[model samples]
Target: MRWHKRLLAAGAVAVVALTSAACGGGKVRGAEDSPQPGTSLSAADATFTYVPNLDVVTDWDPASSYSNEIIAMENVYESLTRYNPQTKKAEPRLATSWTSTPDGKSWTFTLRSGVKFHTGKPLDAAAAKAAIERTIEVNQGAAYIWGAVDKIEAKDATTLVFTLKYPTALDLVASAGYASYIYDTTATTDDLNKWFNAGHDAGSGPYTIDSWQKGQETELTLKKFDDYWGGWSGQHYSKIAFRVTPELTTAWQLLQRGEVSFVQRLNSQLFAQASTTPSVQTSQTPSFQNLLALFNTQSGPLKDVRLRQAVQKAIDYDGLIAAIKGSGVAASGLVPGGLLGNTPGMTPKQDLPGAEALLKEAGYGPGGKQLDLTMTYAQGDSDQDLFVTLLTSALDKLNVKLTAKPLQWTTQWDQGKSKDESKRQDIFIMYWYPDYADAYSWFVNVFHSAEPISFNLSYLKDDAIDKEIDSLPELTAIDQPGAEKAYADLQNKIINEQAAVSALFVQNYQRAYAKSVEGYVDNPAYPNVVFVYDLKPGA
Candidate 1:
């Protein structure tokens, strides 16, 4: 989850006019018109159009924003560092290089020279400091990532230093997708927040917001920044448009007709069809996104750990995976594949008899009183709908009455965090992804103890679990082997020993793009995003 803003409404209007003639069976370059790979093309001939499955922008603010708008924000904002999943390291973005004290309490960063924000303000240590301070002050989004930060000092125009309260991995925290954007602090008006939401930007990114229509045509449009530090000498798109197409069928049809350059997601049936099409190129990669079936441990029949374990074992995981149409696999643990703390072959196979035995022991089977339970998931998710269908049939075997309700994200979350324990659903199902590529996101946010209740819908508070989670960041930064061992112990405790929640399948990031689009690569670190700067027109 993340967010964004727009600029130059007139320019956006002009781009919309151009998009009308360029997209939706417009002047799309055919095989004959496409240039060979690496061949340079002018801006007029290199426009990129993307169709997201839904309205991608939820919050307009960069700081304190945690939503789908990261797809747009990633292109419009820049961070101090960018995490490279392939290398499992932090790479330079705004800051060219950095160094930390041996104890990891003090660090210094060297800013890249000659960069300017879209508002014509020079990027320096002072600017970066002010921007970070603003985010910390607002404390809306993922501000918790900076909990270890004690003080930040602008040592000079080109140098910045950070002192920490403890030995922490500041590098990874600085690369977070949310609350880590470096923007211009200087605003022309006193009401900066109002100015931002009114469609303005101040980041030094490759693209600038050209226009935005909240629920109208071409939801968002971005144009190339002429003064981008990366420089537009290579094959780069001049314009990028994001259209909200809720139906997968409409998006797939548009992709086939070369009306749009890329489609964000497609159903399994459509994905299999796209694989064989000559006009579309499909990519499938492992991702950090995983489905979580959170148990309401604070109240109800599920309060018993045995019942929770019985419920987990009662589900047909294999059938659930097949329902997603090969888009994912049974998750091994809370953390997904390609990230730290994931253990292969750790997931237990479904045992129907075992589940029945546990249910009977808990007085909820044919030999005992029947059990009735309720669950909730986000509406319009086909995969989740399939999960509920299969789960209903499986739970019937245990003489349980399971009621599944689908609601909008806001409604679902509101009910999950309901103050009255009796009013909450027995189970709350949702997808969980990281603000950054760290296992800590899963450990600290979802499982840790929450008083007012944030994302920890499970509502289980174990002191041992809390201690392990709180120690993970520093332990991970200092000792890889120790961290791995600690994660393994915790997984076994939470899933096998305690049965706090059900770990479902991890998503396979899939996308279908027109053949004319080239230089496409899937990075799970930046989920649901395509860097327009790296893409070019191709034969």
Candidate 2:
């Protein structure tokens, strides 16, 4: 995941804006006696090691940590509710139960007692209220997820109520993995963010920070919290370690050598190998994530609709999918599969002739002036590299000159939002996943006209689109079919009618784990996140 920081003004209400940032089968190991709760065990059997294919912690502030650190943050922090894709419902976590008014404008929650943060402070409605207020006050990351809130009241020690300005799904909002975290609001540090960034944690989850080494192979390590409300009674790893391995092959080799218990992801070829290996297990779960190519509609040659459409037509969707060995499916629209607003049977196909004709009409082709364009994607992303390669090959037929460059995530995002229009890349490639499982995440962040320019890399400002996106939240809560139709119309207008962006494909979340690890499950709602607490050492 790639993300950056954005400052929100005092009184402006905008929809959610991002910073821009599985099943398995395998042979069982020899049965062994499982470790009981609070029992000591050896390092080999008690530790669960994970390897991530990139540098891990981009942000440390729980309210604003929206990047790859989510893999760790999810383990350290607890939210009021958690989305359970298996049951298609929001299950209880920090809160025991919740209810909403008939009009959906107000919600009340009953907090679970006997819970305590790492600081030994009791978890109560007042603490939860304070944590949420802090997030909303900072107004970074996905704080906009609470845009509908009119007010929040800590009615009692265990009761919290939320009054909304409009009808909204506050349950889904509370279940978000980003800014929805409930932490210790009574931190003694003058700056809570600085304290958190100094490798300290204030969460009440099942784990506590044991150690952190920046720019080292061992990025983070967490130990079990014996004081956790959810008592550790079953077989669970006592220690969790995350190591940064930039190369997928290196991670695979580590797994083969039994140096790590899990590999977050593997390349297609490596995944195929792991799938057949007798000692390894693999999972392939469809995700809410997708790749999007944002044309510089506000600047450069791509400003022309004809040129944008021509480039869209030149993309070989099937070729790109093949390049990844079917690890991903061609996107039907802006929304990915298994999400709302996704239009079935609408996958795009390359039209070389149509592209050439459009290029000619734009006065850029073999018979006209050559069009030169520049594209920027995250460095070290092999899939995006292949995407650029295939797209470059296709555009060569139309005599378009493409210069593709890879940059660090922060640098790439900064350049895309540069004040000087001429300095921005003509095409910005990025991966998008929802803050929550909602279509509003797409329209509000990427397509709804950027004012101070958040994640709308396209720099578009269409009032019609903005108005429609604004109505979606209310419509979605009140009327389901109407919201669906509105989302469909928005997708068609943006992708097919206006050629606003080039949506490439939706990828499947891939994972490989050692046969000894048990109770592994993948959820699309939180991509690239593993819930190690739910796992235990197999017998």
Candidate 3:
């Protein structure tokens, strides 16, 4: 049973969309209201400033830390492999080279010859194996990412081997980002836990942690790894500083005042404002992130498929796009557009009559049963607010009572993944950026019934869906088109079965200091993970 055939036997499916940066034919907005001229930083005094959305989440463990705040820590702590933006492939970082068995059940990696952690401890295979095992043992949340590993073995001083219980096509890619980051083995689980609780991080990336003023700022200095395999020639930067500015307006002001060289996750309106600033140039990438409405099928009247389908049909995607007034495109399926397994121009079903009919069939028709629904979004995210407001209005037409709730960004995220099950929110909007370009990332792991972190917020568990997801590795390896067809079939089942509804594929926008920021080209591998080292002052 190859992966694709498994997907077919289990049931899986596909849709597409344009991958252009600019939406339609118009100048999208920028991060600030007006342009500020670019400031000059002498080569000798190289420093870069950035504003992350928040202080690093108190939880610093990679398995538990999913917030953008962790990016600061990630920069200081390098992963075994880094995703190459140009090739969209995982390249050696901590590990020099790797090989896998033909059956895909085993993999071995050769550690870099002479790498050392910030504390002057040499990084070796034993340390690497310990790090991998520790992450799996400690972080229950990261299980989905590392669960396939049957064992981690230190073959020698420089060789580490991974034995998988089941074939996993996404094994390598999944390990590239936060999942595969190496940590110090000398530290006990208790010590690691303490660091996470205190928001302290330790790693072996280009930068070394200096000081962290909780909720205010974090400062780091370049360690100048003399033996860095990536090579440190012609590098201008000696230090990087990041500040926590939760308020978008304040961050925008800082950018205008030249306080920070980079800002992230700006809304459409702010982006429009920033577009006019001459000092800043806006860039966009296909982020791995996808904004979605997670329907809790376990509780509430939404347990009925008809009701779920009704809610899906009620959304006015076009109006939602208008409300945001930026680079948003209407999402037509569970898998985002412009990626593999997506067929372009597949419009979502917007038939009110159909929605009403489904609701009526579910005994929730007009004046039949009133629906009181709760939708949660990040507290300060304007774009998410716009989406909620638009979706609320659309649902109201069918006599459904919907309540919009804003949760502290971190709070909502924690609750969404609550293992207690009973404490989980009924409905929430979230995003999924691909760990890699593979369709399996979105379809199999996310929505697969067996995956504990399965994005199937619908809590939909069908033996068939599970089978299809489990079969992806086999299908993909046997034949590309055959694998696609298997996924397509599963997708059709999802739509017909009303598993989950697609909102829109969230567009990624980046604002950096023009070509002055060299090596900043967009990565094709995984749009979400950006390589800071690749960036330098352009010639």
Candidate 4:
């Protein structure tokens, strides 16, 4: 993570990451796994493997790792609470139970006893307290997730209390979030950068990073932690490796060749092929993610509302979907369907003449004005080039010149969130996956002016919009009604105003796994979808 964070900023893509500079010197600490007490499962029952849709591991430290895929890190480090997919609630994992004050300002948790880290250090209140403090001190991108933490007190080995400055429902969300995972404080060092980044980790999960070959794969071998006090899930795989295969076709080929156990995502064009492939099965779950082209609303030619409208109207929404053979619904508002702020009926339709008129109105009509713009979309996204080609064709008809560039997902991601306005994208494409379970995760972080300048791709600040977004806390206190109204209103404003981005479709997230893999479960938090621990042999 960066050294300083100004609350959760918008990530270019759906990935969560902590970025840092410096490769320190130290063999990763906590490499020693003590014999766990209650684990009777053999290492073979815990073995698993798959190919990742993306290849990028930024940091292993939970406090600083911000890559979109943290399967290597998160799998090893267990949080105090974990997001329950079925209930969409934060369920206890490390802590046996917890309670918060009536006003929601203070929370106390009862830690489970007999739990120990890989280093044989007991999981206790002090370790939890220290980890939280270290995160704030380190100030990785994730530190802001716990921004409400005013103070944390360790009352005893098994009791920890957190006093917050703002009343929050974090327990139901943030408690199971990033940076809240307990670490083995006993293994901490002055040079933590060297410790966590050197392919080392500390956690009480069922797996450990046995080996990692950059640009190749991250192999994690596991054994049941008998001392684990939380519920265990997954096929008892002895090893799981995430090999780097950024292309969907390559992933599909890997499965066909018996080189991988599962492919986490299948491109729309290949969805049909997956159906008939021998020894393969596919799961189609609706994604809470949306593909969008964000504008640097803070400055640039896009500042004019008419130009924004013209840009929106020029693109063929349905054509883009057809070109890519995408499998999801066309998006309505900025927030995708299935969330609070989504407004379903607002899906955009192509209006080339409407766009031409708007461009002319904005003083950009053939010979009247020729607007030149640069657009970027991540490389390796299926049919990205086709979408760009169609968009370019429409723009050419409008006499607007567009320079389309394809960039690696990471490069485009960094450019999208660049702090320098000059360096940010005039328009860039990335998927927005819900950071947490609320609209606040999307609307506030992406558009709010108060957040770090890097994340507000639009660089917008409106008093009227701010007032409505500001009322979220109070509205959330009202529970469903308030949340529903506030989110719906926010999404409506964003859509009608042609706010910061050119919102597109929300696709159905689909993944193909070997027929032998049965326990694979879909998770909204992991945007590409599927958890490593849930897969076990099917009956």
How many residue pairs clash per model?
4, 4, 40, 25
Name the better of 2 and 3 by TM-score.
2
> What tens digits encode model 1's per-residue C-alpha lDDT throughout 13-105?
111121211211123333344323233223356768888866655555677656666788889889999999889888999999999988888
The residue pairs found clashing in candidate 1 are: 1-67, 2-67, 6-199, 64-141
Q: Candidate 4's residue-wise lDDT over 1-539, tens digit each?
A: 44122111122223434333222222222224321223222334444556665544656777765554355555677777776667767787788799988777788989888887866688889998888788788877556667778899999999999898777665654543456667876566557666776566578776655654344343233344544554464445555656556667877876765556777667776778988887788888777767777776766788787888788888888998776664666888777655566666778899998988888888896767789888878655655566688889989988898887887555665676676767766776766665555556666666667555555566778778788877775456446676777777777676567556777777676778777676777766655534556667543
Q: Give per-residue CA lDDT, model 3, range 223-260, as digits (tens).
A: 33444445688764655556556677777777766656
TM, every model: 0.91, 0.91, 0.80, 0.85
lDDT by residue (1-539, candidate 2, tens digit) is: 22442211001111232121100011111113222223322335678888887656667788878767788888989999999987767899999999999999999999999998987889899999999999998888888999999899999999999999999888888989789999996765578876777666788898887766555576677888889999999788987878777688888887776677899889899999999987788999888888899888888998898999999999999999999985788888888876667787668899999999999988898789999999988776778889999999998888999999887666777798889899999898888888888878888999888757768998877889889999999988888788888988898888876787888988887899888888899988777788999987884
Off by over 4 Å in 4: 2-46, 175-177, 217-226, 230-235, 409-425, 450-452, 477-479
What lDDT score goes with residue 93 in model 2?
Answer: 92
Mark the 10 consecutive residues where model 2 has the least summed lDDT.
20-29
- The candidate 1 region of ten consecutive residues with least summed lDDT is 5-14
* Over 4 Å off, model 2: 5-44
Model 2 whole-model lDDT (C-alpha atoms): 0.81
